[model samples]
Target: MDLQLQGKVAIVTGASKGIGFYTALQLVKEGAHVTICARGEKYLEVAAASIKQQTGADVLAVPADVTKEQDCQAVIEKTIAHYGKLDILVNNAGTAAAHPFEQVATALWQTDLDVKLFGAIHCAKYAIPHMKQAGGGSIVNITAVLAKTPPASSLPTTVSRAAGLALTKAMSNDLGAYNIRVNAVCIGLIRSDQIEKCWQAQAPQLSWEEYSEQVGQSIPLGRIGSTEEAANVITFLVSDAASYVTGTTVNIDGGAGSAL
Candidate 1:
């Protein structure tokens, strides 16, 4: 399918690696221009270069910490200065902050909210106007299945993601008149840099496939998801192909989540 995304402009946050990186790459492959942002300037630039090499498309690398409102604004401003408009925003910047409630300090909770929740808000606040000017656009929030089914020791991330779900719905209702759509994706255990770190520390003796197989045994689908799998749905959600999808979430959990 064409996706009708050629020449569209997009921004993907936390794109130095993992899902964010793959999503940005996929967008460029589909003929869309992408701006990828992250806190680490070095890695962010590397990611941009890799995307450009792979897709033969131009990609902007913005080193911004999404937790800061000013940085979020700068990202949008720079994007507009370069691309002239915005059509898609993927609020994918975040970190894993799950811990026992008693172990999580107040400071930790605040930081988690700042990055996962307010980060999305800040980006959306700046991106929405440009989207409205464009006459239509799509926004996809990257959340976790724990938002819908919180397990033990899932602290700030669960609460923050639940808030994200509410934000998605509310934004959708408000932006519908402007032809803007808002949605989210609830991710499950997926192969990512974070998971790679864990695997190296916890089970380095095993081959990568062996470790992944062991992890997959716990999931209903008998495997963990890949970054490309998650990115494919996100690309579609932000494309003209999913024009009617809004105020909703698609679970990419491989049947691991209990929520409908």
Candidate 2:
């Protein structure tokens, strides 16, 4: 079970809560020095404190909007300044803006793309050279199952995720020469704060249990995924355990995206 992550350095975006939060804590569990980022400086500080308290691990919380170039660069620069090297880059800063296909406005499309697609792209752009200088590194893009499944009700998220998948592949192919492995994990119905936000706005009538059940029932596993479960996959991909893995998107959906 040695993930070989001890003493390594990692960057996890949107770590204020949800999957990014879990992923950061998980890395700390494996003994990696983690730097987490999000737009809200307030939430980010609270999350950083929680991670440190929970794991007794050192954490640096950088308040940076991954969607912007300056912020992305600051994340990289700050990591190197603090940790001296960056071992893993988890592009987990994304949002859910799915609506009926016809109702998705052009502005909404642009907003989603700016945060999800360009955010990953910008992070990768800065990290590649650093990885080259450091001799190698791993980049894990946090996409979702919708990339392949393309839920009818979720259009923009799916389209943008599809682009993320492409980004993962192309980056992997191009960066493999530098010993940088780029891969993505397609998240399923993981219980997280994002779901809470959506539920509050979309299905507030359903109690959490009922809401979870409604979603989990569709999974062959008979349950929705956990933050730790998703983090395990991400950690594996970024760890030496998955050294040969790259140019791929591993679906973490509980048979939700099962191929015939």
Candidate 3:
């Protein structure tokens, strides 16, 4: 099951922790050189060090806010400067808080779009050229199940993810001629730092195992997903094994999303 990913250069955003960190780590495991970025410098450095220690792969940690155009540009610039070519771009930056439409503030909506939608746009805008120059590349946007099935009280996240899905499709069509492939992975309830924080803040009495079981009951698979599970799919999408896969949104939910 060779992914044919040796020496491929990749950039993964929001890789300081959680799914992003796992994705970058798995890419390195599959023999890819990865540049991981996040807004938090401390966590980014620590993550890079851990990945290097664990995988013995070339890992560069860049601290940049995805919401800013300059930051996104810097990420691409530094990646090329370090690796000399780009093969994969995983736009996994922002997370939007859930709220009802009436309760959603204008500021909140704008900020969500800035981090999720515009963040991908800025990264792709710069990465596309390098991808084209390299003759081809893969781009994976880490969206959510809410993009296709919007539950009540899910405001900006659903809207933002829908935009991301659309972007994935549109980019696939536009870049196919250049041999560039674009796709997305729609997430569900996966264990992560953010999810753990929310659980702790809301249910201080529940241990992680207890809370996870309670949450998994609602999903058809009877358990939440793992970071490695999501990362495996992403790594595949970026590999030669998935050379024919593009413009598709694959749901990594544990059968939680209603739509196909």
Candidate 4:
């Protein structure tokens, strides 16, 4: 049952909560030293503390906005400083705005690309060397189904995420020669903090549970997926179990995203 990940070093950007938090927890459980990052210093610290307290695993908490190149490089440097090497990189930091495409302003569109697309580029640029030093590693970019499904409201998110998928494949094509496997997972709706924020702001009249169910029913699976569910597939893609998997996107949408 060992993933052969013991002692491996990983960086999970936007790990303050949600899927990143669960992904980091799962990696630590499998014995990987994880570095978590987010923009909010206080919340990032708290997330690190909570994960450490629960798992008794080594961790580095860095407050860095993924959109900033300097912040992205700082995460890689700090991870190497603590763990001496990087074996896995999870580019998970991103934001989604549920606005119609017709209404999306130029500024909003620019912001989406800045965070989702460019952020992945910056992190991978720095992490590749450390990964190359390790003789090869895995890079998992956490994308969303909107990339394929094309959500009606979240136009910017759909476009940005689709761009991320392209980045994943392109990175895989280039990094393959170096033995660094790069892949992306097109995530479906899950119980993440960002979704919670969106729901509360949009549907203030509905209780959290009501709002969750309303969204869940729309998914083909009849419920929203758990972060752990999404992380397991991601974990497999990064682990030795998926050694041959690269330049591919595994969609975990509960059949909601029947993308042609």
* Per-candidate TM-score against the hidden true structure: 0.97, 0.93, 0.95, 0.92
Candidate 2 all-Cα RMSD: 2.2
- CA lDDT scores, all candidates in order: 0.95, 0.89, 0.93, 0.88
After superposition, candidate 1 runs with Cα above 4 Å error:
none
Residue pairs that clash (backbone atoms under 3 angstroms), model 1: none
Worst 10 residues of 3 by lDDT: 206-215
TM-score (C-alpha, index-matched) for candidate 4 = 0.92
Model 1 backbone overlap count:
0
Q: Write candidate 2's Cα lDDT for 1-260 as tens digits.
A: 89999998999998899889999999999989999999999999999999888988779989998778899999999999999998899999988887998999999998889899999999888888888998999999999887886767897898998899999999888999989999999988898876778778877999877777777888987777888899989999999889898898888878888642
Q: What is the lDDT of candidate 2?
A: 0.89
Model 4 scores a C-alpha lDDT of 0.88
Q: Give per-residue CA lDDT, model 1, range 40-135, as digits (tens).
A: 999988998898788787799999999999999999999999999999999999999988889999999999999999999999999999999999
Q: What ordering of candidates by lDDT runs from best to worst?
A: 1, 3, 2, 4
lDDT winner among the candidates? 1
Candidate 3, which segments miss by more than 4 Å at Cα?
Answer: 198-210
Q: Model 3 — TM-score against the truth?
A: 0.95
For model 1 the TM-score comes to 0.97
Error of 4 at 48 (Å): 0.8
